[model samples]
Target: MKTLLNVLLRLIETARILGLNYRDLKNAEDLLMHNEFGLCFDTIITQMYEYEIEIDDELYESISKIGDIMNLKPESYTFMKELIRDESNIPKPLKDELTRIITSLIE
Candidate 1:
């Protein structure tokens, strides 16, 4: 379950990197479903750290909409915190980038 979640999260990160809309997760899913799923979530998370993508208010609104469709509570900080905790091994750069992204969305 963790692995799957991490894969999905990495997909989200990748989508962000490519300037893909988070609200359009179908595109992300389609892009990732074909890729090999063998990599460790830590590795993917680390890559996310290496890449910095800005998350603005528009992105947050889009994420909230996507979360709603996916039955995820975007308003909850707990899930975000848990993601950060579980991905603690991520590189400082990617972690900082993601932190800024998620933080902006939360606010």
Candidate 2:
């Protein structure tokens, strides 16, 4: 499995491909390096949503897998659930992963 930092870097690369400004994530690398997992994850997801970046299933699955390691907070869970619900274009696999996370939270 890819480490969280590697995932974040991949997101940055995606942002570059989309021509979106990725300064927030670039700055947040320090947080991840310092072991600030929650903030790093939150920032990546928040920026992705704000920029309206479309995540493919493979990348989304990687993010989902790392969520537990990040120790996501309550609001992070809510944010993810909302992301899954609101993004109509989300790929099925990505949606399924998000659904799994939200369902796990509910249980």
Best candidate, lDDT-wise? 2
What would the TM-scores of all predictions be?
0.30, 0.54
Write down the RMSD of all candidates, one decimal each. Answer: 13.2, 12.0
- Which 10-residue window of candidate 1 scores lowest in summed lDDT? 77-86
Clashing pairs in 1: 49-94
List model 1 lDDT by residue over 1-107, tens digit each: 44455546654665567554444545445544654332322233233333433333443454444445445444431122222322336645577889999999999
lDDT of 2 at 3: 72
- Clashes (N, CA, C under 3 Å) per candidate: 1, 0
Report the lDDT tens digits of candidate 2 across residue range 1-107. 25767876675665567545658757567677777766767777777677555655555656666666566545553444433433456655467889999999999
- What candidate 1 gets wrong by more than 4 Å, as runs, is 1-50, 75-107
